[model samples]
Target chain A: MKKLLLLLAIAAFCMPTWSADTKNLKYVDGTTLTIINKPQHDGNRLRRINTDKYPDLTSRVRHYLNMPTGMALRFRTNSPVIRAKWTTLDTLRHTNMASISEKGLDLYIKQDGKWLWAGFGNPKFEGTKHASTMINDMDTTMKECMLYLPTFMQVNSIEIGVAPDSRIESCGDIKRAPVVAMGSSYTHGSGTSRAGMAWPAQLSRMLGVDIANYGTSGQQKMEQFFADIICDTDADMFIFDCFSNPSPKEIHERFAPFVKKIRSKHPSTPLVFLETVDREWKNFDLKKRKFENDKEQAAREEIAKVIANDPNIYFFEPGLYTGTDHETSVDGTHPGDMGYQRAAINIAEKINATPALKKIIDAAKAKDCCKSPCKCPASKK
Target chain B: MKKLLLLLAIAAFCMPTWSADTKNLKYVDGTTLTIINKPQHDGNRLRRINTDKYPDLTSRVRHYLNMPTGMALRFRTNSPVIRAKWTTLDTLRHTNMASISEKGLDLYIKQDGKWLWAGFGNPKFEGTKHASTMINDMDTTMKECMLYLPTFMQVNSIEIGVAPDSRIESCGDIKRAPVVAMGSSYTHGSGTSRAGMAWPAQLSRMLGVDIANYGTSGQQKMEQFFADIICDTDADMFIFDCFSNPSPKEIHERFAPFVKKIRSKHPSTPLVFLETVDREWKNFDLKKRKFENDKEQAAREEIAKVIANDPNIYFFEPGLYTGTDHETSVDGTHPGDMGYQRAAINIAEKINATPALKKIIDAAKAKDCCKSPCKCPASKK
Candidate 1:
């Protein structure tokens, strides 16, 4: 039994964190989050679609039956109190809506007598029964615990700040980073969750940079255009792609000027172009197939041409694989959380293309560096 | 064969019209995206991160290459564009950092000539190769086109507005919603993007109600109470999830009266409570999981009791099982986009328990309205 426990622990630690779908899950030492802004209570009223049918109630819940993303519920102060949606990536299928003890509903609260959270008026609602079909996970995965507090202890309103206090204070003078993207709805990310997907956010993590996201949903070049809200900032650059929204004409038209605009501003900022990602083009429309063929050739040639004279400009072919399919979207255009991870992987790869990595690879080729194929350079040390 | 083609076309139409992964693929319509929101520029700066080894580049790319999110070349602007991560949905293997792309990346482009809307920094660089696996039905998802347009077409700035001309639009002056939230970092949608993955964002979508989200990265709960700019008049309710950071003593000592304070102003408004989300219990050291576990439970229960008699004061179970997982995090405590989605789903389910949705369900149950299951009223045609 001792040996078995040891093996389990080792297996858990040594396991490859990344699976076939997303980036490798890194075991973080501690979690940290900071709120830049909190949800504000705006007094705008929705046209209240379908409301006459269910009057006197706040909103209807029927539309959320199967959507993985939907209208999230919040209290007047903007804290999320209730949520409704279609499907979730929760293969454990642990419904947050669970009514504990077959009380049909449960809530959380502080033992000291404050109300922490409450549950549905109809506590009898059982959770979704078909847990197996609800998930997309591994056999080894177990159901994780999630609890709903009983009503008496829930509270409202609080401050927002960081933890463990990373010595680095402040984002520092609102510095901005130049950015470009290429992918599907996952890239453009939709809904009122402005900037939620991360093409704009993750970049902030990598380079301590800020950028504007110009991605759109469900647009594969049908209404494509170059950058809008081009600022006068000296810190602009361009990154172009035609992967998720494959269109020969749009790419054919936008690539050069897009690059030119950034070159016009931050001429020193490195410009990079991207090749299309992979999927089953043949599986879709004939028009898509035709466009894809044209675009691939055009992309390669244009990339070759652009880089021929300008060394600062570069190109990155997507170097990862994603595992979504036609059914990956709640509506097909917007990638759920899974698709967003795919976009991140591809983006991360492009980020890896810096000159430092190139030197590492060259060193590996020469077989003069450390034993590993890739080596980190001696840093500021 | 003709009949088969017709059938195939019909089938495609019946399928969800959008997919996050399948950009430019087959859609029921032959024509592509009708210009929803006009395209705009998304830019970022590309400061070479890996300079020592690669001398000319930055270290940003080097770190990216180390992860599984494949690489893609991007253009830079104000900030780095990225796909924020979410907790592992137990359904998809529960590996937080799975490989998202299999082969070369898929490029997505808005239909407009917008300059580098994918974000600013160029992801393309030397040595970034394509992933080996490929997502299904995604070949030719997009085409990378290049062209040197006549000089007249380029511009300096364009606005990426939300209007009918764009994909999303809101009308009228209500300008606000019933509820709002104020919190520390936990309130800010972190580890996820702003548009689609934040819990508040997801909750708003689920409820079809406008929720104001003001989450910042790395904020602590203390900051919310200190925030005093007023936007409180429009709201109908408020909720607070400060427990994500509060100590047990804090929950008992500070949370309850804070809620009552807000209630003093909007006496008619409902308030909800939230338990903090933490993962210390998962791998809780010698310490009993009781502190985190029991406290979370107590908080949820207390809220329920308060709301038991009042229609306005409601409680929600913090967790439930659906098809997804809730145990995901980069640092373990912060919920990823998946976690946020899960949080929202939990809230949404409880919202379904509200008297509002129950009235509809009860009426349907009374008549035994539909086919196999208890039928609810049909959606308004």
Candidate 2:
């Protein structure tokens, strides 16, 4: 009996601590993960811009700021399975946009120098709190990963789960300066099917630099407070997709001051203005055509004046952002995932075409190269 | 007092019968309109395939058939405004698909020689009954139009409204035979943002022929009953997207019998089989990769035997139906609108490239020439 008891105790001591069941997985607070694509990490880590810092902004703009449009959490882990539990501030839903893009999470794994989509976290139908198993059953290799937050809903709390014995750690911040984008619903990812497919997120992955999104839905009307926020942001470049929502009169009144305020703070930072893509519904509605044409003309006039005066400022007319087929939009106004992809590539091409913009992006890339122990000139300096 | 009353009565009688307010707009039952892209009108006008005709089908297949996958209402009207009121059979919602694509109505207007998207009817967030103004403030020119029904929800009742004084009439059925498509959720527009963006609908518009959709969601397993329905369908061509849902063993057991059953009824009908698309998630999940590879190999082996014996049968492997960039799907398995667009174009190209298929399509076009006064050979006959 003594010998048997001793053998049982020895076996118990040698048993492994972890189990394969996902219920045994350990969860880490999302805030502890490396939050990326934000101009400043002052208030909520999930939100793109802090509302408390600018109290004078319109209530609508402040509300929209609470939603994380293009934010992502970066981490490294060797766990084969990943899970997420989160609560949205409001269980908001849209008719034309999928709930996965509006309030759920999207996961991407970095494989061999490229980030590929791995899985999606599906949101509950009618609830604020939701949980989903993102991906499972893979060889446990240390992999860098990104989890994109909700594009059109605010987050209250989030937790990421990994295997009990796996190593998980934050991927620290990117050393290079980020590109700041301010715009309307198109930039807010209104018609995309996943959060990571948003144009700003696509631009970041394509350029290998951070692109902080400050899209405010229908509230991006070139407000002075927005200019105040943009001017103070730490960025290598600024892009404005702000021409779509404001009235022609408002554009005429606010365009010059908005540009001047940003220039006053960061005079040498490259600024790019994008003309609004023509809405598909305008083809049949003459009234909308005239209204949009007037707005476009006003934007062109203001941009022409700014471009002539400032050598660092550049303007790009709408290219094949949404293809010429006129079948890319969901509600005749908001472009779907395909349009967003085309828009990202078109914007990148435009940036590469200009020497000034290319120089700024190249400089940022050089700074990124200095992160490792190397003999590169940037590292040596 | 009597004189004043008489004058009031006279004024009331002189007033026009029609009012500009949409509240006063007259409603027409959707069934009164010309229904298009149906194989046989034996049961419910909205459903793709009637359950009563195929009692042997699985309950899941029967349930999916109740949803109006690609049915449309054809009409002509001279109204400045168009509106719709509908009650869905069940107010269903999906997390990964938008409500607009699941339950809402999409309107297209024929202009010159092409059908162009005019507007979309947004469904109520949490209700069975919904009403919306699809379009307003257009010139009162007589226009032919198509209104695509919900792709994933069944309709209990639907009514189209127009200005009280406007002329509205049915635009009778097309003279040419429809192309019948049988498949899974992709053909049912699972990832598309609107009902009209489904691949079958896109194929119809691109080819200028009616293409009846018989998609049954996750239940398209190449069943013997499905073969009975397809064999009886009045079609110029039959397309099978049936290899996705079945297991390799099921395919080995059912594929030859399923094809042979259809061929038994129609000896010379052109039959086309589409190989299942490679799921994007398989690229990362090795288990799924092997499983899907096995299924594909089974399909190829079975198809090789059929093609060797039959000359009228054709097979198409997965092409660039979704672009190579791997960013076109909403879920890893289902293609979004861009992917559907690519699939439609690719399928159309394949059909035109083949002499046997092109000859059949051309014959259908020639028959369509008899619609009006003409000197064409088909019209003379």
Candidate 3:
């Protein structure tokens, strides 16, 4: 059995899924999807903004929402492009400099030549009688974008030192919540920034659970990828969706071993295996006579069956939705809300119906017996 | 002097700019910014997508799009993960499944299993059906989001194909037009699925010149990536705004290398560099520190200047709007229309002001120049 497994592993390693090469590329016309993973620092600074501050930017406001103190302020020419190091605070600022009426604004400037920087601070943002030298002048459009509103004059610094009490609470100490989806960029919550649309993100919203997304584009299948995902964070449940790369035989060899390794560590954790379907599959390239589509789908099914023997392993098939039926997917592959709803429904139903969940919920009820989202204390009540 | 130059070169190499390490980590909240190089397909069947029939989508839409086809559309069913596979017409006959469609309607379906995939074909979608599914099967709040008019379908196939004509069109074939932006996700106009909002789409409206978008997401910096952009396609002034990565060093090392490589070969094609920016820096833990913020910006400027010496390498700075400024960024990084419009203005201004551009415009005025969507040649001309 060991030898056979080794052979299978080697077989999986041999077959690589290379995307078909094309001469003419159809660049999908859509918004570039970005992943925002930076933690915001609520620096306690008011003047931290050298650029005009718009109150409506919630993300920005959120960063500074918990600011503990005031910020340090810096000044520059109209643009953030500090042309020459601030030899002296040049009083020459944008015309909107008049808006700095809250305080006086005047400074001297000098450039030996090389670069630009913000030097001495102007205590007053507005002062009438100061004629300052302008460095690289701001252009016309710059005027338009600033909307005639005054820019905050260069840069600002805000100090946000945290108290000893406020820090990343350890998951073990705090009854860790297990609701993170781990996978590739697909799970990273790509597109829907407005609504936060990645499948896992949508799932998080639907389930009302905090989903720690451990997805990175182009990093799927790397051994280190999963090691970090499993070892770095703690979660109650893990929706395993790593089927994008592994070849047919490879999945068979890997799934059993990987799941076994995970089970040893997280013996009781509900590990749900999610198989993905690509929109490109529907694009029709192969000969149907050979049941090429079925061959591929069968391959996926075989992998599912291979893992299905374990009663704890929950397997999902991508049925139930009327495909291509709704204008739900922005790209035929990635679904929009219609797709989101379908995904939520399918996932939640399966989760709710699971015996493992029933056991956990029942056990929790027997102990604390509060409503859902209950705090399951570890006092052995 | 040579030793000094060598010392300077070594100093430049040893002096690193980016200290932010993005190593083994799931995500960093707002700080994660991933920029795709000029990505292209590395496979064959997928290339079928570029056919002229689906001129926009590429010719082999069915194969490239990865949608399902045929009568039965044999989808795998078992442990019940509905992944795609082509079942025979007889299979469809047995199942009574027909075509797939993405149209005006909502979708909601919950599976009793772990996950579900919609069939290749979309079922009849009535607005009420989706609402009913959400209300009954989904959490009330989640259901509310399910209802919306369809924007665009996730694409699958293009109906066009290009039959090759051996005639070689060199850089000399290019007409010096105002400005044409090329390369992957950086250029092919993205941001929204809507046509008007794409940077190129929007810029063409502003510049009164056709600013073509060659950007495709998930792009990689590769020779194959530029193959079609150079030979199969033509542009006047070109802006390569890919500096978001492949790093500055990569840009300096490969960009000119590629240009010189392309130049050593093509010799006369004009190329410009558009620097990529990450607005996630605004929310960085140290953003309140003016010095840190300026360092990142300065690094971008430094890289810009390194190559700025070449007259043809026009540097397009990321407009002053940080990712936060444009709340429209789906991921606090990819610009939204408001962001794109802002970006377009910067590039448009540069292109219009170039003396080389002035020369091209003058030559055009001397000709008949009344062609609609003028088929202006590329630079070598």
User: In candidate 3, what are the lDDT values of residues B67-142, reduced to their tens digit?
Assistant: 1110010011111111111111111100000012122112112122111222222222222121111011111110
Q: How displaced is residue A146 in candidate 3, in Å?
A: 30
Supply candidate 1's per-residue lDDT for B124.
Answer: 15
Q: How big is the positional error of residue A44 in model 2, measured in Å on the Cα after superposition?
A: 1.7
* Tens-digit lDDT string for candidate 3 (A259-371): 66676677767777666544422321112212324434644665576466666666666522324433233333444323444565667666667778546434532432111
State chain A's TM-score for model 2.
0.90
Q: For every model shown, what is its TM-score relative to the native structure?
A: 0.33, 0.90, 0.30
Candidate DockQ scores, in order: 0.03, 0.52, 0.03
Candidate 1 segments exceeding 4 Å error: A1-337, A340-381, B1-158, B161-174, B216-233, B278-281, B284-291, B297-311, B319-327, B357-381
Which fraction of the native contacts appears in each prediction? 0.04, 0.61, 0.03
Window of ten residues with lowest summed lDDT in model 1 chain A: A130-139
Instruction: Name the candidate that leads on TM-score.
Output: 2
Top model by DockQ, which number? Answer: 2
Q: Which ten residues in a row have the lowest lDDT in candidate 2 chain A?
A: A372-381
- The regions of model 2 sitting more than 4 angstroms off are A1-20, A173-177, A366-381, B1-20, B173-177, B366-381
Give one digit per residue, the lDDT tens place, for model 2 in A247-287.
99999999999999989999978888888866877755545
TM-score of 3: 0.30
Better of 1 and 3 by TM-score: 1
